[model samples]
Target chain A: MCQLLGMNCATPTDITFSFRGFSQRAGITSDHSDGFGIAFFEDKACRLFVDNQSAVESPIAELVRNYPIKSRNVIAHIRKATQGKITLENSHPFVRELWGRQWIFAHNGDLHDFHPRLSGRFTPVGNTDSELSFCYLLDKLVEKFGYHEPALNDIFTALKEISPQIAEHGTFNFCLSNGQALFSYATTKLHWIVREYPFQHASLIDLDVEVDFSEVTTPEDRVAVITTEPLTHNEVWQAYQAGEMILFQHGRPIKQAMTVVERLQREAKDPSLKRVTKADQY
Target chain B: MCQLLGMNCATPTDITFSFRGFSQRAGITSDHSDGFGIAFFEDKACRLFVDNQSAVESPIAELVRNYPIKSRNVIAHIRKATQGKITLENSHPFVRELWGRQWIFAHNGDLHDFHPRLSGRFTPVGNTDSELSFCYLLDKLVEKFGYHEPALNDIFTALKEISPQIAEHGTFNFCLSNGQALFSYATTKLHWIVREYPFQHASLIDLDVEVDFSEVTTPEDRVAVITTEPLTHNEVWQAYQAGEMILFQHGRPIKQAMTVVERLQREAKDPSLKRVTKADQY
Candidate 1:
């Protein structure tokens, strides 16, 4: 229904290279071109740019492509209008403030009848199931911890408890970030790649563009890119299994407890359960 | 200490011409150049752009000058950093969502020892006295009317009651809008002008730029421009009295009851009370 792109890094890094190829999907390489949005985090704050126009034609997207905005965490989305109209208010990724820090969220798949009760300060300004879900998640977080912000591990635990329930309705792939880390979950399609020391040349799958990461990055620079689909031809993009979730911080994934999806798999002998599979393994 | 520019129009209007001159104050004609931000309201939602870079040199600012984004209400600020560090988070105008509508605010003056007790959902993300005052106002609004948004007249009354209290600490000139109307308050420097049917040529004070308004506007179109200083040299501007607040809607000022400043001035027989006056009549 839509597409997502996210980046987490050990240092402040720009998304121009990956965004160039990813944005092409909005109108050129493929058509998910109803609207587009991007958020670049600078510490606890972020600059969010959104337009109802196709990314290929939007002046704001052109600025995003040409200007190199460095950030530790970034999230972007190109919409195909699965649930909402093609209006500026309906564009993703949507942003809300929590505990005095900005939180950004973008969704890639459609959910059927997935509106959860929202009883907190967070509310959706647009009429989209994506924004509704984001508000619900934020409400759940506030419900669990009140006005105080919880630690990363506590947040991951809360998400692990909540993602599977929503995934039951339909495809629930999403990327969320609050400047500190990126949290991603997939029920259908999602991929990620980490670029680290001794990086090599990579070729874009959509356009005739190539970049040698070694030339532009120091040995200490590390970056993790997560997207709905692979954007490069040469790099090994790891595909996420259905109902799987991952948390990325400081350029790499930190090992955690089994996701609710995995836990449900261990209890899959129940007749009411459906098997969650990788579908496409890299 | 800073500068503010706001526009409320009867119809959607692009602010390129006025912004061209207003932005010059960031680094060219004057130097309130710690950072700058602008917000353009498209209905209940808005597009907010902020940068730590000076408006004269920032590429984002350059894009703003060139691209004609239309909006009914707009707010812009050029910061001098009286209280916070010159970071992206400290830039104005600041935005927050309440009752599913985005509220935008920008301040042109400083507050001294004006931290009010905040016991509500709204919180300041940056360490600026201006943002603290905004959060306090929003918190007060929520306190008065829980999750439901009150009527515009009620909001005006609440602001009329609260603005004078904050002004007691220091200069408290500000412009606030929620896409419905623009609310402005001043204790020192602020001016406003309304342009309607009879349009004529106007020249900029900060730059050698001139434009004939009749060439681009219709008789039905009306716009009200509010700023710390008049941007155009040819147009007549009206200055605000100390502690005065005005509510603007449909490109015209709606008649309101006496502001607290006027009330205090009428009761100025007390030896302890100081008189508030319009220092500049024109």
Candidate 2:
């Protein structure tokens, strides 16, 4: 398992507050101390910083915590290394160019025995099931839209249709961004919160740090933060359903979808496990 | 014109000392300061930091100067923005994925009216003639070697054949790396030096900084540095000819190639202007 943090804001903003809390899980508060990486998107261009060192110890991660890099979209990951070895080549989030736009992605859960065919154009530089799935999704999107970049809604619909096939393999919680918007999907655990005009003071759950957002934000500012778990204890975090997908833009979710239980029931390889899931949901 | 700095070393090494003087040229000593970027390679993985702000003022650049990030291959660029606007997208060096490896490049010269036809696989996100030439070169390499990666010597030979075609447009001095070896091509100005055992004192040309290298390095340590201009005045720096290409690996030049002067002489559109170059030699 891994810890993921993402932000999609209406205006350019820094993630020092949230990232500081989230990175504590890398070594201090939690034990996901394999490696970590983050990506910040400024319009269509992006800057990515990755290291095989733990986020708590990496000097580059220290720069991220102290420097106020303004961006509307950002994604960060702290790894526990379930599928890949602890190496720089295996660190997330991964990036590739498609339709003349850079796409970034990070995964939290593990997949068992999942491999998809890839088009020669987009190949994974590192060996990870997450990277393999990312390349597969890009190849499928290119096949769907050809050389032209389609509308955001069209992409959302296509992702909803294609996500279940990958999710059936195992836990498939992930976050993806295309600079314009962020797309998040969850099968096991994920939570999100939106902060707007009437901001209030919040305290970190892992560390003794507090901040009054009202003093730092203007009336026009809005932001959405998503993560593997609630980062702040006071804020109301919304958990996604077992199989749900959401596209976030301008600090809010613009579209949402879910796989119906009947469909999952029909697609499951073991019918007996579906009955167990129904009992557990109660 | 921009300034480029590159390092290919036999072992993992830090460039904090060299970069301190090199970054001083952004605004303090010289005025090539449109923006700046640097990339460090750790095996097949990389860390790229680019800022559209001048290195003298960028806090990220400040962090770079202070942090000792070690790598075997490093490339840095300070831009003057000849063909592209001053923005994050237009900052060099540009990156692309080819044959399942990350390729990084940076340019130091201007190209006028040079746009080569691109095959759809590799596209330039930024509007720079430097990026255009990089994509053109990668496309030609892929066409020449299909899916399999060729031997390094064979690739060097192909670059020797293809570089003159791009250089005819104008100055095409650039450095490229694939995490394995560094390939440098120059048409106007570029210099390189190899530092090994029995090192001596060196003084920076642009800044009042001097360091005795003998105290810092071991007998097994070796490093090759390539730059647009010589950084240290006291060291031996060899300049590349009008059209020379060198491939550096294990901290030394393993192969070299030069384009014939007769070819460049024949390709020049203005025949009567050759006398100006004759005076430069004197």
TM-score of chain A of 2: 0.93
Every candidate's DockQ is 0.61, 0.54
Q: lDDT at A131 for candidate 2?
A: 81
Q: For residues B237-281, could you state the per-residue lDDT of candidate 1 as single tens digits? A: 999876678899989888444465465665666746554533222
lDDT tens per residue, model 2, A1-282: 999999999999999999999999999999888999999998887899888899999988998999889899999999999887898878999988776677899998887778777767677788888888888888889889887889999999888867767876777889999899999998889999999999998899988999999999998899999999999989999998877899999999999887545356564867654532331221
Off by over 4 Å in 1: A256-260, A263-282, B255-258, B262-282
Query: Alpha carbon lDDT of residue B44, candidate 1?
Result: 85
TM-score of each: 0.94, 0.92
Interface RMSD for all numbered candidates: 1.2, 1.3
lDDT for residue B62 in candidate 1, whole number 0-100? 89
lDDT, candidate 1, A1-282, per-residue tens: 999999999999999999999999999999989999999999988999999999999999999999999999999999999887898889999988888888999998777877687774877888988888888888888889888879999999899877776766677899999999999998889999999999898999989999999999999899999999999999999998776788999999984344654665566667465555332220
lDDT at B85 for candidate 2?
91
What is the C-alpha RMSD, rounded to one decimal, of candidate 2? 4.1
Best by lDDT: 1
Clashing pairs in 2: none
